[model samples]
Target: MKKLLSILSFGVIAFSCQQQTAEETNAPSVSEESLKAHIHVLSSDDFQGRKPFTEGEIKTVNYLADQFKSYGLEPGNGDSYSQEVPMVELTAMPSETMTISGGSEDVVLNVLDDFVAYTERVVEETSLNASELVFAGYGVVAPEYGWNDYEGLDVKGKTVIVLVNDPGFASGDSTFFKGETMTYYGRWTYKFEEAARQGAAGCLIIHETVPAGYPWLVVRNSWSGASLYLDQSGENFQPDVLGWITRDAAIRIFEASGQDMKNYGEMSRSVDFKPFSLGLNATVTVKNKIKRDQSKNVIAKITGTERPDEYVIYSAHWDHLGIGQEIDGDSIYNGAHDNASGTATMLGIAEAMSKMKTKPKRTVVFLAVTAEEQGLLGSKHYAQNPIYPPSQTVANINMDGITAWGPMKDLTVVGYGQSELEDIAEDVAQTQGRYIIPDPDPGKGYFFRSDHFQFAKVGIPALYASGSYEHMTKGVDYIDSLNQIYLNTQYHRPQDEYDPSYWTFDGMALDGNLLMEVGLRVANSEDWPAWKDGSEFKSIRENSMK
Candidate 1:
């Protein structure tokens, strides 16, 4: 009996050793060296900041294709690695000043200073000539929340001035529109769309730094430059003009109308808040240089051995602000941390996947999308015209900005509780001696801001996360300070250039490994992650699967 027991124990020990060896051998090699090389090249001036519809686009796409080919990855699109995305470039030149009248006194807001406006219309010119202006609170119409800012208000042929965020942010009540966590209703994109649906001729949001999650400078720099949009073809509802006004500008306009801006802002926090006319008229014209063009979404994939029909996708936007308003005498917005890091990380994962000893059972695709800075147009186009059916596409793992601040004790998942993908991510994170946390600053609406949101809208469970906020060695405060510096100084600015001096990739490598393992688990298994019950995307996915 003792000899038999000894033999069984030996067998168990041998089996455990074999399993560990297999895991170690099959683990993807996501290296810091690879990540740094990709980021440095992509963010270099030679890429011209990787803007679409420019020489930068040509250089960037070709480089990505070359890298994928070098890694022995097959083209994702049939017979080609590039997917053409049709777009229209609109360089709107608004009038020097927006004039307000019919108030106690006329007030003129300077363009790019106190106000910034642009039009999505494809026409050469559009205008708001003395359009009646109404204050429409947050411009949100959520039936579930029983809040309707446009109720009983006819804004047709008029301009609606709304607040940037929703009432939940103002009230800080979790039951009210998800509290400080900004919902889609709080996003400026939603405000404009709602205004257009209400038949408003124009929509302007009042920008407050904290609620907006960015300063006036970011607004000016982003909106003032040439913008790109998916070729609308007159299919969508877009107001004649969409814009933003600084808080100071809003105050002046309100004062001219004999109303206190502070009081109105406080009142907007309530669900019963009603829309009212500001007794003012706005006049402005936007002349545009319209150019229709095509951008490329670089795609590469590895076909699964067992389940080639099912897919797992990885995405990162490869576009940035490009050459724009000069800041500190530098015009190139290198977007090193904005997206180059994320793109590099994706490439690292691709390299590791390509070198795997055993390929995943489900097809794995690497999608490097374009024009995300211009409101996620590349991803939007792909979602609308998908190569793989959304129902068959198992999941999308998106990487936006990757932290350079070394490894973290936790991974921050944007829109944390929305999907079962979070559960998978949590399991994978635990293997690395790390944990998962929801985004600390949900008021930024980051989940909707990135390319993953497009996939989510189409019912594909998407995961966007990074090792952030709690550095392994530096702690939380260190990460926060770095984030603040990046937000205040480098974000969307020319100063976003990569400097190897302080930038580190150990953390990025850790994140890449985590993402790779999660995707591998999904791709090799028969699981299709579903959205959580309370997620807004849950119904869309359920209906599609049916």
Candidate 2:
């Protein structure tokens, strides 16, 4: 494994700074006011939460393209600044009652409260009658880890209620499936996918705050709206019904089957665990209002001086939890910090590149994608079918939520140990007296949750660095507290609106510059970054680069 930069190399930081082309008149000053201006417009209430296939998306993409034009940047896709992403919007409305019958009495699970169900199959009425419920422990089937939660257990055409996260978390065994640091198997998406692979009719993950990393409220708000997915002509690669049930609901159902959920959770952590047949059977009926439309990905390019073909990408999702459930009587989700901040930062960096006196050797593309709140659909589409082919794309630096409390003393590199891009982040962070830290909670599997992961999937080394949690004014504890507050109160809620009083651009401003500098470093470099040891993407990168 590659060790960190030696302490003696700290003095070499100034030497590294000398290689930068910042002295050129073209190096544009990225200002806090400019960042605020972009955020104000994009996250404004007028944008209607920036939901795709709505007026919000139209306004968001147009404004982004217009800004790119005003900044004197060229269109990224063909001759147009916009690239259409055809999607099928499904507003699935479940029946009021989901009956789970087993013992003497039948339990009627409430929709949007107890569980949320969805089917990607393009059908008018997708209903399941008396689907047997199977408790499949963690619901993971990885041969590499000698794990198969469904080993010798047949769950085909059954509804499997599994615990969220992985065995390592429940058992607190570090050697078992990455221990606290969640592998991809710990991700909810992986659980659902594995169920589909096993031919399970339905999959419902039991939601626990510690393991899932968010309160059940977040699940309700996020899952209770119109969901957007890529319009595919082939077979839908998803379960007939995928859902999440509150921990309370899972416990009640298990108890009805005479199994203590408290002990059942403990049993899941063991490799010898077997599937429990919950005598309970599930009945589901879903009615969906489907709307087919095309959303645009706003693409703007600052072409390189030398290797115009080789590209460097800067990305940020422009979608949020859209106008959904009300909070304090406010329906607008504003998404000011969730992504409006990242979108603004992407724009600010692009603007800086536009004013540069010297263009780098590789082209830089700024992509503000749509339908991110729907599961990074926009970036996935771009990765699968690129206007700029993924092979030519050198690196992707994605900006998501940037800590806005104030100036920070450190930077947290998500997927920190996965690639050499962290080296670039570390080098730049040192110049500003800021240190580099890995994602504090890898068990959340945040590395796979963002747009950069899509790029990485296609063999491109991608960097997504979260803003420092350690603040200069209040210390790291205060910063962590603020993050928890955002998670509990503001995230994905109407309260996530912009407010200069409680937020600041001091730290975000520096972050934007760091993104720009990192991109410049890669764009101007002769060698491409390689995925580091222990990264699943390493072999893929090596093969693709070869």
Candidate 3:
């Protein structure tokens, strides 16, 4: 059973700090009972995995609105606590005959087992009628690096097969890109976007377990179901087809096309490579079960006493994979750690702030968005259609998956060195007797994985940070193993159900306080925070502010 956060009165928070003096700043006091209550209720079996376009979403959104009202906040969307995000969900049913035939080869790759594909265009039907295939190396065209895979090639209306990750990652060259650490160019999203910009009829990334990070099972589980995309409103440049093919299946397909993975894979890592035809004609006829609906983004705000227009936003995604493919007799993807924890953690901070004696000078928003699991669609929609101007928003502090393990001595900032937020974070962490560290695995490209990236794309400074590295009992090694185990077994699986048996509340509280402190400092100060000088977002920020 889940316990409730210690409310001062029924439906009202009583725990408010008078001032952030030296003593108060040294420790954070987020209620464990409060955190547990939010998590258990949100992740309960009755919620139907908290998926959108279902009963689960209804309960989740209504509950969040009620919570926001109870916490004495104003509805963020003018008089409504909810913002309707329009989306076009497509469930592509790939035929068995979807194949690449040419070079005397007849290869019919099985769906899910060998590849996964979908369309980005807002259409019920999409087809690739034997589109000519081109091997476009890594599909990158970075002018800064003087690298162009499609240097002399015109791939218009042709299907392009690209390698995952950038050249530096493939070659392990320290001087190239960011060495083993993946750059924005290495992400599969970048690959697909680039292909579409290059006028490709279809874009398929060849997936290798190591370079792609997760195994093929992850891809199948994530992309197999009803895929959601922002209604393009008839926008072009998004490819007719976007997908991934497994490494083993890629090897077989390459050999049939009179090539081999070793030769092409090596060639992709070199900057001297040029795009060439694969001698194969790729074909796919997609039948989409289309659904159009609006997902809810539960938003409310604690209006600032003075500068309400200048806002500080707190975000947490509230959507997860609904009922789908069964695994070991379980069907619902609970998403307990993936985001229920994050939602709860954000709520705890809101509750704590509600009872404070002094509100910040700038406004603070509590936004629990939907369809994040569906490719950050909800946040993407919000960024594109923001309630307030992006320039007025000081920062977006996104919490996605708060560490439920025991206490730690360090905080792990995902995008560690991109902004001055890290500097502020370092200052706040020191008082709590915790050091700040970058994500140990930068090669995974986690910085671009969460909803914060959406806000960052629009020039808003965003922060996604977590803790539980140096455990109060065991050390860093122990914490690392626990994270690995969670990813391998429970992440995005039905097994992610809430289990308080061995869960720790102090970690969540501490992380929550750290986030609150970061926001509190930003909200209270007259000085605005910004992206660091050499950061990619620096110019974007400069332009937006101007």
Candidate 4:
């Protein structure tokens, strides 16, 4: 018996030694040249902005597939690296006429400036004629919070007018619902989803640039295009009609009702907030042309040597504003920093992992999702219908809106406290002589906007760290100014086109390296990362593990 025990112990030791040797040999390293090269191709004008459902998407997917093949990545879906994502494109034509009523004075809402409306259903035309308008305050119905904006109100045939952000924002008390941090409740997606659940004929969210963190022009451009949605196999959560009313337009409606819009907006921030009865009504006639279209989720897999069933996913959205109305002379909304940097980094990581001699213990999935700028649709589809079982999936590392200004002394983890993945990132960051910082503006709810949210919703812990505001070389003020300049002048605009003269890709290389290190730590770990305590995803992930 002792002899047999000795032999067993010896076998285990030998196997352990072999595993360590393999890991040491196969660890991936990010190369400066590779990072710059990938970004150059992805941000190139020839790609036409990488908008999905167009010829641009075709080229973009093929380019990724070809790169993955060269990097020795196995096909993510059976024999193909592409996953077909069925989508419906609904285009709401510019409204010819719109009106407001139920007020002491008659009010006419102007198109382009006042409101933007679109149909959720796949229809050629849907009209909201003299629809009853209800002041649905925050438009939220969180049973946990004992809040219901639709309480005792039958909004079946009515257009619900809701406030932007959560009541906490208006309340200004951190004790009330996540303080200034925008909860999922503050998200526009949630507003429309909740409105649909309440059976509203139409949903209109009042837009405040500060709360929305984006201008009305963003809505105009995004909604003006052929809005795409996943062809939900069955009944999905979508409102009958969804739209946004400018703050000024909302004020006009309130003024017509002989009420101050500013005062009502102020009341919306209170905890005991109730839907206001804005003695005002509205009528919308939406003329939309719906068409079925198809897009692809570009996927590539770096097969594991031992734990092939377990996986780590790195993702970024590839689609952007295709060709929008010209801002100046340029028309293509070249989403360079918005996501071109992200997609490029994803490709960069794939290259590094492919060059490694030793394969990771777990499979590494690289996904370049589409239509994130739309509403996180591409990643959402993948989460609902993943190619791999969610149980074996370990974590997701996402990249979006990478910095082009310069490298930072710290890495900002958006949704910083949401997951255990942050610890892994910190360890990696430490190795690079950097540290991790919480999101500078949690009130923005930026954590919920990107593709990572889709995975997080389905129980996969995801990381969203990027270069920070504190530049490694220059001061914070310089970096802030440059970033502000980008936001005001180029971000999401045609001017976002690549400018080699201005962009210092060496900074991108540093970011790509840090991200690559984070992925490596997860790929080699036997334990799966978890959402932090109190995170909504924590319970979901725990259940999924079961």
Candidate 5:
């Protein structure tokens, strides 16, 4: 009888082990209800459009925390599911006025119609009066590439105006700056940062709708609202005035400097390109008031079984254009595809993984960041002040503006040619009977604009994949038209609301599965993914790994 009891116990143990193994290998199926439910709640009117500082933020963050708790995810930040990202929300509304003087004749560039400007320095009172202006060519500093735009120039007490993209982008030459693919040097954020480092009182970027990827109206709409930034604790960070000037205004300035706008634009692409002081001068006067407020970055994590110290992070921004000035009587900019879908998808993935009978070998952090619409600020904060050390974090899987259309035959990696993450992505895609495709417009610079960039800057291999419209059920042409319509009319506007009828979430599930596979492969492996050869981030990752 004792022998019989032992045999039964052994049988039970074997069965349980097999079950656990199956659970670990099998992919979890996501539900439509799960996706819709989360997104609906997040984009609902009661959430007040999920703006960071308003009651909207409170409702949205609490909902995210409750959902994380329900999924059995551990609090990501020391017994708390939410990280209180202390931010000073500033709203600057300046009356339109800017004056410019140069040459024998004085030129005054009007605000709103000609240019847009704002200040990062939190001051009760500020003004820009007759500030000397310097034109910085493609405002970039890449020591590795032996390029410097501010060579031996003191920009203090002066306003620096910069061209839009990198030299390679402007030059249409592959050998110049990463070619059409924009380096971080091409990003507006980098331009502002370089100017700040140079002690420039203010920095202004020339805006071309094609290179900047949106119209000046889009810029105005975005900057008109409240801007959020991580509040500085000490005196190390210096804030400066940041703004943009229209292409026509830029052309006028170039003409005033006795240079043809077309010739200068072409000249900027050459390796011999040097920062020249545009003989024209620019002056602007601004008035603004500042207010301080706070926001939250909702975070949750599932600890690993073997390597809990190491992590895989999945992130999406949760905030969007909330309660914009009414356009055609529609006030709420319900950012359904802009990021509610991405945020909801992250939670869905978290829920699916958390329900598995066996835990992963590495921790998975689901981060729903704030103010990506404002300029990747929340991700910037998390990257600099990470909950887990960046070196231990394997990679960042980021989703921004996921497709609402149905399934397709391909996946689009924003920065396709940059790193080895594309290889892993392709391997996963093959399993789904899909393939990987590069962004059609490398010149558009979608890679630098997303939240994944923050992680990439800190030497983490990051993946920014979204659904493709090439083979949707409605046909490629229809799918393409739909996306173009969204881009033309709805992007960053009040019309970005949920449309249950047209938005087939079939691709959402597929995208989620691909993300799951990528994380699983990274989580279970002993190896770390690295950027490819000649990539700027490759050396950094190698050093961090060592």
Candidate 6:
């Protein structure tokens, strides 16, 4: 009887081991509880809005490194997990009012109310003293589109006022500069760069609610404080002033110049539009308090057992607007949804990957970039001075934000048709009984807004996607209404705090799982995803491979 009892106990123990092995063979599950916990800590006020060059930055980077170490990930950089990004912080205090002359009548515009401006030049003071003003249409110079708002026009020593978005947005013609979808030329940064290249003294973008995708208050809030820029080693060109003016203020300027603003706006929709002088002169001075410092991009990696040289990167920005002008008695821009959620999602994915029983074939990197709000500076630095060869880098999957409105039936891919990664994402979405969709509003230029754009420019296939639009229990309308509310009231404001009673994490978990599976497939496979034929990045990738 004793021998028989011993035999049964051994069989039971063997069977339990088999079951545990089977569970380990499958992908690890992403936990909503884990994600919520991470978001709660990162978005807390103690982080001080996670701004670079502050105590907030020190805490944020250290926390990320600690979390990665806990997940068993090795430091991505040799002997260190932080990549130092050199930057300059410029706090510009402009004149109280900009005075305009050489028009029908002199017009004075209030600083923050009617307009907001700043200088990227590393100088103590820069001024536009009676600089001639020109209306440069969209201020775009795209050779491929056969459009040049500054064609045969000299803007040297002058201030140019340009429209907010590209002409294709106004015409809605699919053949015209990518139709309603904004190209790189439509971005405000591109406009400023082009103006500086044209030797313009200053550039002011006219702000329209629909075209600019936000109210004037967003422009005021974002540009009013200290702004960060790449040190550039004094190589890049920057205008004396870069700014935005309210629609009302723009109208007054146009009226003073004896040109109907509405007529010029209509004419700008055509490719034949030409830049013309507004017959106005402007005067303003900016005093800058500049500080040069170093910020960090936190990185960690799970080295592949097989092809360790090739890599698949997952990236998210860890910086926000920081402490600013108080609103609603709350001075912290927690960036709960704007990016803390994304950083948490990356952490959740890293934990899952670290626990995988069967490791990936290619190295997987988790990168938390800095100064995305200041303009994708960390990623830009990495792209320019890559630790890994761009040609050997397999792909990049970026998360800017994750939905908190519960699970969704569809995943929206920004820059949907740019590469073959979307195809893989679609297949992964199907496994979860979800479909893939393109961004509903492409004119906002979201594809160019995030860190992924830096990778794309350097010839790597990158995917920026999330599960949004069609909720599981609530319909599409419900999701749309929530998005509107968030954008109008909370976006870029101090009120963008985490609220446990209102926020949910199931949706974030689902999206995180989908992204993890997509990345895992890429990491284990031998095939390198290629850019779609007409993609602007195709040539760049092709040349790099050669």
Cα lDDT, all candidates: 0.91, 0.85, 0.84, 0.80, 0.79, 0.90
Query: What's each prediction's clash count?
Result: 0, 2, 1, 1, 0, 0
Candidate 5 local lDDT, 64-155, one digit each (tens): 99999998899999998877677776777654766666756676677667777777666644556667778778888889778888887778
Model 4 residue 397 lDDT score: 93
Q: List the residue pairs that clash in candidate 2.
A: 26-356, 26-357
Clashing pairs in 6: none
Which digits, one per residue and each the tens of the lDDT, describe model 3 over residues 167-280? 877576777877777778989889988988889899989988777878777888888768787777768668888888987777877887887666677778776677889888
Return the top candidate by lDDT. 1
lDDT of 4 by residue, 1-546 (tens): 997787567546533543453355464455657666776777677777778777778888888889888887888999998899999887788575468987766788777777888876776777777777888888988887778878788888678899888877746678778877889999988998888888888888998888888778777777775788888746645665678889888888878878766776677666666675666667777776767888999898988878889999999998887777888877877677778888888888788778887778889999989889878999999998999888888999999988877666678999888999999878766655567899887877899999999999989999998985887657689888987777677777887866778677666766777677667767887887888897988999899888
Single out the weakest 10-residue window by summed lDDT for candidate 2: 1-10
- In model 5, the clashing pairs are none
Compose the digit string of candidate 2's lDDT tens values, residues 1-546: 122354336335533552343553246656789888988898899998998988898889889999999999999998899888989988888878788987678888999889888777777768778999999999998888999999887888999989888888856677888887888888888898999988899999999889888889888887776888899967777878888998888888888888677777778887678887888899988888888999988999989888999999999999887788878999988899989999999999988888887888899999998888888899999988899877788899999998778877688988878888889988887776678998888788788888998899888999999576888647889998888878889888888888878788867887887778889989989888888888889888778766
| Candidate 1 lDDT by residue in tens digits, 443-518 | 8888899999999999999999998889875679999998999999999999998887888998898788889888
Model 6, range 421-489, lDDT digits (tens) per residue?
Answer: 999999877766678999999998999999999999999999999987998657799999989988999
Compared with the true structure, the alpha-carbon lDDT of candidate 4 equals 0.80
Evaluate model 3: give its lDDT: 0.84
Ranking by lDDT: 1, 6, 2, 3, 4, 5
Clashes of 4: 1
Residue pairs in steric clash, candidate 3?
A: 5-34
**Candidate 4 deviation (Cα RMSD):** 8.6
Mark the regions of model 5 whose C-alpha exceeds 4 Å error after superposition: 1-24, 103-105, 233-239
